[model samples]
Target: MSIAKTLAALVVVAALAGAGITAPPTATAAEASPPRAQAGEEVFYHVFFRSFRDSDGDRIGDLRGLTERLDYLEDLGITSILLTPLQPSPFYHNYFPTDFETIEPKYGTLDDYFAFVRGAHARGLKVYLDQEIQYVGEGHPWWTRSQGFAGAPFADFLLWRDAARTEAEPFLDRATWPHYDGRQIGIAMIDLNNPRVRDYFTRVLLFWADPHGDGSGRDGVDGYRIDHMMDDLDHKGVATDLFAGFWRPVFEALRARRPDFRILAEQADWGFGEDWLVRGDADLVFAFPLRGALIDLDKDKIVQAVRETEAITQADKGQIVFLENHDTDRFMSLIDDDPARARAAAALSLLLRGEPLLYYGQELGMRGITREDGMSDSNHIPLREAMRWSAELDAPGAAIWYRGDKPWWTEPANRAHDGVSVEEQQGDADSLLAWYRTLLALRQARPELRGGDQRLPCGDASEVLCVLRESGDARSLLLVNLGDAEARPALDATIADDRWIDLIDGGTVDPSTLSLAPMTVRILGTP
Candidate 1:
């Protein structure tokens, strides 16, 4: 069936169900209907465009390459994608933008970006563009015009330490870095206190949210991932307390223009990020504490993290949960490449009470860590290496941007014949990729796992972490063995009364007699 027809049929089915005319006859009075769509139900895949796939074979991943991979993402069951910064930048990561309005020349043109968005939307997937508007490189017109020009139009655009505008306000240590053009250029923090700067970004955000200004948003991005979001502006004491003054206004403006637009914030401190969601008017915040807890594999720490997350996140807002991202070391490396631990981590990530984020290549057990060489921009290359598509690691679509003479490619995580590529894992039932697909499918089929409230049970068992998910009349229990040995944790009497259908293996089992293998997860739903 065509996508349009499928969508239309779904709408009709939803309308009939709302009218109380459609439901299975066997559904009991205690059975819960499908849960409504919520922000936390979305599963997002984070993609670094420069490392995902390359279409033109310039060794760099681009918009066209990403567009071609929409089928893969959709089949993997992710509802959204969070792309790294796409604006023209002086850095390979594209975080330090020189131009915010246009696409990077290496990626593609604006038309290509629009086409990609359209293709993603047609597949019922959301596209979230990453925005790092707080800092501008020396190549930015605002920075170039403000330098040494007393009456320049953009003189107040950047924050300077002196009236002469010779020294830019320090971002970390140095205010200047070598641009892609091989010349040292100044990097200046934007004066968020200035109303003009706030209004400029508001316009930029709105443009991306509705590119043609038709309010249809068909060709535009669905949301934005704000990078390094901060209220104190790196604690420099320059742009202080921007939540109420700067960000709230911009977010309000964007929402006024596009009510359904989403803003996912990355807190600079990597804390709970409650302030970003409550005060900054953000819809989603990163669950950095939960991520750390999950990687440590401590049951108490994991329970505590879940409690803290539940306490802070509102019903309308959500947290983005993940095991690893572009900035963090791979989960496989963190766990010493243990396949069982990796599978358990995947279960926790998808089953947690938040919007799960899957980093590209994470499902394939790809491993990488930070390489601290002296060369600028080379340190992060290892973590952002190419995606492994074939057993030989030289497939046509593989993005080998960091190859040749670089230490990153020499000792790369994606080795040939390593059984970590899509080609190797496609038909392997026990592969990490297959495990991810199963978890994703289960999460989709069970509404309780998606929009349910999480309660940590089995607290007495220190080696096992248990989470009871409840939404309306639906309930499910997730038992995870965090220990290295087998764990036979007893469930609460109230929860153990009902027989459970093992969602993983499709077998009936009693919850009271649950036994978990080492580093494994079992999801049980009330039968």
Candidate 2:
């Protein structure tokens, strides 16, 4: 048989299986029910469990705090909560995990963790944990005790090399490194090679998720976000045999229990060229390229990065696009603290393809950066500023969430003018926060923007970046001017007149001059 025919036959088989129509053709009567939400149909919230505050200033964000915000999230149409590590760890970020099974005491107790999960589930929100297993503190119990590190083969886990035996070799400075604070950073790297390590890892996962583990496990976790995947672990290279052999089984077990399980990886550089997005490890990968394109100063490089990333990933690739995330410098700060540019970037992300993440204060134009301090806390600035709720202060209470008090870093002086509070922007149609709402609503209204056939329109000049998106009955044209001047592309000679319509400027037709302000983005849709 021809290759095409064979491929077509396989697709048919897969479709039949998906439909539950077996070879003998047993068909069950359809139950009247609502359709499951499509991929990318659901929105997610990235919360800092430690930063959120209430009436009492405990300096720690807890499960109750997360639960309190569930209504807000549900009201905003958020279907999932991507909770950062809930496990006990020394650091604020929860990367250096000491115990995978227990909830961090600072955050909450195990009961508190379960209560949050229960509340989210009651509100139809899927809960997923951010698992950071790439490296553990040098003081992890397994590393300190002789027998704790004994079960695995020599190659399973990682070791902190105290000294280098050869001149041409890689070594970790045990003296000055592996220390989050003056503490021993007792996170011992787990040897992945040891069958024992695998057993422990599996047990940890099952302990939290396996409802049957304790004589009837209630529900396993919905998904996971693997952190620091780029760092080599257990000698498995990023794009090679390691992930395929080790991580694959753990994922498979979870999928077998809940087919709806979703996994995202924090392999920031993966989107650059690696085919890991759909290579079985993760359901989705962070769209670092899109983030880079939005913030990088170089105009040409930004466009090239977008084009290259789009070319590599498959059409169904699950990637999250964002202007800023938790760890990075705030987008507002990166855009010269200009609210206008920040609004434009937010608009572009909503209208573009893929799932987009909006860091907590991004809607309010929060500005902050890492300081040059040896202390980790000093270096890592808080994106979650205090919420300004007073209308008497001339700040918009219900507009957008803003930092009331100044964060540990630089802050906006004129909170009213810089769009720093949500209350002010909520009502103003021209407000940056309002623009984001409209943009996201547009994504919901237009399926083409969600998942469409995208094309970069040919421009008269090399400096212009013109793109088109079409899916089924919907179509859109995105014209981004990365350069400094207004770009007028002769459209009359370029596009078919009857096929396109401009939604932004009252149905303006193509083949006319496309004006793009410096660093501006224009969206045109068919009427």
Candidate 3:
């Protein structure tokens, strides 16, 4: 089908589905409900496409494969999917793009991408594409042409370190690196101060926001995640004050086109991200401090981080609360594969004030850590290993793209028959995947958990982290034991009335007499 026709059909189906008539048979229970009206209420799933699923026998994940798994995301109650960069690149992660306008050939064609977006929309899911327009690979047309020529067409596209224009300013360290194809290439940072470069990237972002230019956005991404966003552009002293001058303009143009378009920024400095939210005009930012505190499993640290975050963040803006992403080590590995701690982390993430982002394979308790082998792109293979769909690591839907090529695959985390695959945990009630599902379902059912004001109520209890969520008349309390011993935290007397119900296990309890097992979670609310 043509892109326009496919989008039209999706819209009609979505309309019918929304009206409680003629719903798709494949739709899960989560899809039968109305779509989230506000972006802050969404539960986002971050996907590294190359490691998600494989449709063909090429052992690489593609758009078609992801489209085929929409049911899984719906069943998990994910309202949105944040995809990593899909542009053509010479690297495995596709962070630095060779071309901004085209989809990676290994992933699929433009038609396949349109189909994926359409399928997601039909399931009441929003798609957000990741863009790293701050830099380009050596093979990019802009970088290739400006290599030696002084008066090249795009010579001003990149920031050069010399008057002769023969050297490009390095961002992370070196300006040159070996490409995946074993050829040395320059990693040129874009000249955001240049008006022409800024306009070119703005056009690129707008094109993806509405691929067909019909303004319906049915076949286009709903938003964007700006990767490695910085104000000073690597502190090279060029392209300075980008939050006010460069990013705000691009964001304004995008918002002008689509009023509700969301912009998530990954702050380069990884601080509290207040400046990025206020000055850069970002709607959401990664909760780096909260993530560190959670990983540390320290109650004091977690509470302090939450208080600081609430102080700086505005009520309208939000943080993308998460345990792991493409760049970080998996949460399971960080916690030594402790199931109870994992469950507590899940509860805190979903029941927190901000929108929660679950990294792909996080539900299955997948484990990995960064390798210290070298500085090459291959060093991150362990952290970006394939999603475990079945007990056999090489199963049909498993995208084991780096199987034999990387030695990290043989680690205990990636071992077969480790009970970390969806197939192994689907029917097990006490499994980590089931724990995640339960928390997600609870978040979907309760409005207070979605967008409520958070308050820490565990007074003097060093081992327990208590979060009280209130949305007008609706109120819920999430108590998580971060310690290895049992905890009976003292709660404020005004927290509950006559009786409180356990939302997870479904029972009445007295809030004053509450007790939590080691590394467990209990969500309590009025009966």
lDDT of 3 at 485: 82
Per-residue lDDT of candidate 1, residues 1-527 (tens digit):
21122223232223223222211111122122222234667999999889998999898999999999889998888889999998887788898888776678888865577678767777778889999888887688887877887578988988888899866775666866653234665668989999888877776676677643445554567789999999889888899889999989988877776777889999888999999998888999999999999999888888889888878988788899999889999999888889988988899999978899999999999989877654355666777878887887667878887777556767887688989898999999989999999999989988888888778878665577888888887888888888878787667788888778988788888866767788878889975
Across 13-104, the per-residue lDDT of candidate 3 in tens digits comes to: 33223222211112234334445447789889999989999998788999999999999999988899999999887787887888776778
Assess the local accuracy of residue 506 in candidate 2 as a C-alpha lDDT between 0 and 100: 63
Best by TM-score: 3
Q: Which of candidates 1 and 3 reaches a greater lDDT?
A: 3
RMSD for each model, in Å, please? 9.2, 10.6, 5.9
TM-score-wise, the better of 1 and 2 is 1
Off by more than 4 A, model 3: 1-37, 178-184
Please write out the lDDT profile of model 2 over residues 99-184, one tens digit for every residue.
55556666665555656766676666677788876556544444444323434333234443332211111122232233324354
- Write down the RMSD of candidate 3 (Cα, Å): 5.9
How do these models rank on TM-score, best leading?
A: 3, 1, 2
lDDT of each: 0.80, 0.56, 0.81
Best-fitting candidate, measured by lDDT?
A: 3
In TM-score terms, candidate 3 sits at 0.92
Output the TM-score of candidate 2: 0.76
